[model samples]
Target: MNLRLYSYWRSSSAWRVRIALGLKELEYRYAAVNLLEGEQWSEAQRARNPTHQVPVLEVERAGQPPLRLVQSMAIIEWLDEVHPSPPLLPATADGRARVRALAEHVNSGIQPLQNAIVLKRLREKVPGWDRAWAQQAIAEGLGALERAVADGGAGRFCHGDSPGLADCYLVPQLYNARRFGLETSGFPTLLRIEAACAALTAFQAAHPDRQPDAPSSDPATSPATSPAAAPAAAGRSP
Candidate 1:
């Protein structure tokens, strides 16, 4: 089978897909799509996903029909199914439900709130929307995650001692949290879980800054994912 990933360096959703792929040891051709430059809105990308979202996975097998999967959560779950080793979901049915609950908490409730598109729309509708608002939204959303992780579950991971789907979802959102200058010190427990996740090679490799399309310099200094500062090989699909 051949896998193709359409991704942007700093897109949190794309970051989630990459983490799942790395944890499964899945080999895929990385196709860099600069979302900020309206590349994701291009006809070619729109053909793949009408929503024009990054992290679209194309599953191609020689004799079978190619399937396209969109949305990070869906793609991650599919990755677990395609490559069972180092499974993303927990083993037991109850455990799987619990993990999915935590994942859904972030995936559905927290993540979509601060996504690039949502933020853009928010800026238009709410004239006061700014970095401060982003900082507050992230704090509230992730503060809830902190309470859930602390009171509910997560061992070395969200469900148990091994890294699973929850970690994959949460870490990238934290990357986005950092971008907004969210104060994570208030949520010590969540930060602790994130610290552990950051140590894992899967999470580390999945980081946006580590992606081929990421800037060589520090992102905190130059924040735009703008195509102007794009690297020479930025548009190529590998």
Candidate 2:
């Protein structure tokens, strides 16, 4: 299979898909979509995804038509289904439900509110509303995620000892939380899982700074170098 990922360096949605690809040990070409430069609004991108979002995965197989997958969660789930060695989901139905709930807490409940387009509109219509709104939305969403993980039988990760689907979503959302200046010190369980994730090669390779389109010299804003980049823990799955 020939895989190409349309991604933006700072996109949390794209970050999730990158982590899934790394964990699955899949090799893919990186097609950088510069969201900062309005590349996603171009006619080409609109044809790729009507939503005009980053993280569109293009799959090509011999003698078959190419498949264009949109939305981070859908793309990640498809990858998991096709490449199941290091399963992104749990084996049991109940466990799968729990992980999906946790993932959705970030994907559906949190991310859309602070999306770039949403924030841009907020900035234009209600001056000074973008940052404050993003901070509040992320704070509230993260607080709920922290409580859920604490009460949801979490082990080394959001669902179990191994990093799975929820971890993929959680790590990137936490990066956005920090980027928005939200104090993450209150979420111990989430932070612990994040630390565990940071140690893995998959997460490290998937970080925004490691992407080809990332700004070359912005160490202060780079999550890979930020204070939140915790020390690696032992026994983390690859």
Candidate 3:
């Protein structure tokens, strides 16, 4: 597809892009942007995305400069629109709205509050900020999400039978929620949906642990196993 993705293995937003690419079966070159090393703020990366974020999809066309697209949800939506075979959003506007709402519950409500940058700032400013602060925020958002799903009559996935954009957003946030030590067993519905997603090849391929840049003890540069394994200040999904 002549696509190049600036990505980080652990960033939820980047993870979302990864899942979308996998689901659409679109091949793209991956450029790892080491967010924990402050690489997102570097001149080259910032030139690609002024927001200095990972998960920027560079769409390359013949005889033209690569088109840089920023933000995970926006990028996913674009992918859905451009590659419409297996649709990410449902056929109905109402279904699309419901999915978007669920996705936002994680992308905006939970992720923004709990990501490395926001949590770090809170800890720096607050008297005794702890991971619990993020935990509480995530718990609240998940609780609301659970209720929304139950009330909306969610099927195997967030929308109907098929996995959609909401599922993409949910899985990564759930991963981060566990990393931050939040107890997610309370949300049985989400847990069920997560398990279903786990069985999918696309979701499995997009997992942080499966990424080429995933942290490893053998590789010092591995973000997962390194001393600086935590995500950077601007590390959350956008």
- Top model number, lDDT: 2
Instruction: Flag regions of model 3 displaced more than 4 Å.
Output: 217-238
Q: Better model by TM-score, 2 or 3?
A: 2
- What is the C-alpha local distance difference test score of candidate 2? 0.84
Clashing pairs in 2: none
Give the C-alpha miss distance for residue 70 in model 3, angstroms: 0.5
Residues 98-164 of candidate 3 have per-residue lDDT tens digits of 9999998898899988887887788888946758898899889999998998775589998888988
TM-score of each: 0.87, 0.90, 0.89
Q: In order, what is each prediction's RMSD in angstroms? A: 5.2, 6.6, 6.0
- For all candidates in order, the CA lDDT equals 0.76, 0.84, 0.80
Estimate, for each residue in 89-123, the C-alpha lDDT of model 1 and write its tens digit: 97899888888877888789877777788788888
Q: Give the Å error, residue 131, model 1.
A: 2.6
Clashes of 3: 2
* lDDT by residue (tens digit), candidate 2, 1-238: 8777788888999999989988887877677788888888888889889998988888889999989999888998999999888999999999999999999999999999999889999999999999999999999999999999999579999988999999999999999999999999999999999999999988987888876568773533222221111222111122
For model 1, the superposed segments whose C-alpha errors exceed 4 Å read 217-238
Separately for all candidates shown, the number of backbone clashes (residues 3 or more apart, or on different chains) is 1, 0, 2
**Residue pairs in candidate 1 whose N, alpha carbon or C atoms collide under 3 angstroms:** 154-158
